[model samples]
Target: MVVPVPPPPLLASHVAVRAAASAISHGRRVLLNGDHPPQVAALGRGDWVKLICGASFEDAADVRNLSLVYTLAGVDCIDCAADASVVGAVNEGIEVAASIVPTVQRPWLMISVNDDCRDLHFRKAEFDPDDCPLDCSKPCEKVCPADAISLKHSMVDGERTLSDPLRGKYEGGVITERCYGCGRCLPVCPYDRIRAVSYVRDPTMTAELLKRDDVDAIEIHTTGKGTDMFNTLWDNLSGSINNVKLVAVSLPDIGESTVDLMNTIYTIMEPHFKGYNLWQLDGRPMSGDIGRGATRETVSFAAHVASMSERPPGFYQLAGGTNSYTVDYLKKAGLFQSSNWNSGTATSEMASSHQALIGGIAYGGYARKIVGRVLRKIPEQFGRVHIEDHPDHLLEALQEAMSLVGPVKGYIPSHSKPFMKQVDRQ
Candidate 1:
């Protein structure tokens, strides 16, 4: 039997398109007056916001949509996996956002690479569905935030008999492209069938991507065990490091030695690092979507690093478990845009600097989680969904995006007269 497909929501699309246009026009006014692409200024002002499209997430369509929505929302940067196609997808999204609002400043495009295969961000979950017991509950599917796992039971033959009614095998396992190696699936597997496969990006290819005109930055994910692997990767990236406007090192907080490790890494990059550098204090890794509590680790991590008198020279930012609550927590901790050092004792040089104590925050799983809700509304029959195609969905998605971005951007509320009237007229 053939299933009937739902028609596109054309009327909603028209109204939403108008609303989206109004919102974009109103929200992006901040980009118009910046002398140094607002992103850089944001870094200095401590309000920089970046969208991290997971280092292992290579779904081009989702990457493109996320890029478009976040760019319009006024994020300062978009970080994605360091693959040619992924980089192209990010640029495509930025280009589309620019098309919607001519004056919208293009956020810097940052690519993520790993110095070692052990980094969690550079892996994927794998398993054979056939090995899974038919009687066991599929907790792996339920626990997966990315919805990367899929399993269905099918009959061994064309028909099922009374004695073999439950003898079907499982089919259709992990969607590799959608999996970001969260590892939620591994622990949930009843049969212990799930395995994580990790791989490091080739430095040669990453170097080539850096040389691209559209590529604006690169992020190196390191285990923080030592500087040897990072130094090796830096050597491999050598001259290409100068091609970008910024370089970021993403690392987990490793206690008292974190500052020392950061200093060592900075030393390795300082000579050839001809651009702005950033330190991504990755707290709790990929747990942002879990809940409000997930944000605490990163905020606490930021508080720790911000208080350090001799951490390093690069701008500091928070990541790993950031979500909607991050900004509020930062504010509560007195780190949001505060120029004063946490210890109330800034070096003479720091006192004269214009930069904030903490540069900004990067939203990863949580950012994607909020926007992915809207993207999921598009019908499956629509195939590869370009959110812009369904303006109503785009507007909903944009509004959702704004809810997260507005706090950082200080966006004018959508309820303002002009834009509300546009929505009302629709």
Candidate 2:
């Protein structure tokens, strides 16, 4: 009997980096995959794009990480260190661009800032030296609710830089890499350097659906807060339809309403509404496209509501999912979208007519309506919290509050292990 030997499997590293003289084909262009030229920074990436090459830029009010290599369509991150020759209009290609930021596992989850902004300073850039009017009374500290901000002066590679409201200075200069892009302090600040990153042209996939002739699929971004708040609001508005028109939603730590609407929608709704949705997702329609607040039933129901109220439902899902991340533009929208029909603009609305109220908000309606439902449930688990309806200026004021006191709360080193036990306790 003769014996034969098999060759060992080759590792990727061991494989030769060879390329033929002929062009290698791709979705459109032929990539050499070897040497690449340097890239020049173009205009800042567009925010909140409505149409990306006639496709879907704002596919979801909040599109979590679909892991789409938009690079195929020439969608590249301004910060992406990838090789150039592979970007831009190589052929009659790339008519649009997606927000080239990284996606989160949960589209609706805001980067739980939890900051306390005070006397934060930019790293290496001395306000006194640059003649920055250098007003450090820093109102941002007084406003941040999450305690994720701070204000401090420190050294970075041996330079005095003021990084504030963060209670700590940048090691060198203002590195956006260190910023959560909350921009809570922008309006209050005297300078232009400190700013949060918001989507440029925040897409409205739902609105796009509204413009179409056929309404088939629909997505609903729900907070696992609960359904009671929504039900109450709906029930109380027994005869009013206008109150559900301009569904104004807000998330916990919005850059401001100036930011996209979707991000704020996730947080503004009472947590009760969010929690109920989550419970129902797990107990009831678990088989449908139900995911927490974004239950398949809820989405379908929202479509039903929309169809009855306005149009048919399409493929809509809650902005929050288990595969999205938050940072820069990619995860920005989830930081805003809300749980209910502030106006049923997206999948958050329902059909309810309130005779006395306007724009779906009525005096004592939301509170009184939702309060009974909360009381009926786990009385031990329920606690009453006062909520304020933010006027546009009020929203700006809160953003200013974030500005005056946001950094001290937001700039925590992701690697820091001090374990903010009290933060969790609260």
lDDT of 1 by residue, 1-426 (tens): 999654344455545544554565465433323345567667667878899999999999999999998887778999999989988899888877766665666889999999999999999999888788877678998899988888877766676433563588778899999999889888877788999999999999999999999999999999988989999999999978889988899999999999999889877888776677888999989999998899899999998987778877767889988888888888899988787434211111222355677878899998899889899999999999988787777877777777777777666332222332345534
The residue-by-residue lDDT of candidate 2 on 95-196, one tens digit each, is 111111112111111101001111011111112213223345545444331122444455555655454333334223232222323334456655554444
Which stretch of 10 consecutive residues in model 1 shows the poorest summed lDDT? 343-352
Question: Candidate 1, 368: how far from true, in Å?
Answer: 0.9
TM-score (all chains, Cα) for each model: 0.89, 0.20
lDDT of each: 0.81, 0.21
- Which pairs of residues have clashing backbones in candidate 1? none
Cα-based lDDT at residue 51, candidate 1: 96
Candidate 2 residue 338 C-alpha distance from true site, Å: 18
Per-residue error for 73 in candidate 2, Å, reads 40
Poorest 10 consecutive residues by lDDT, candidate 2: 16-25
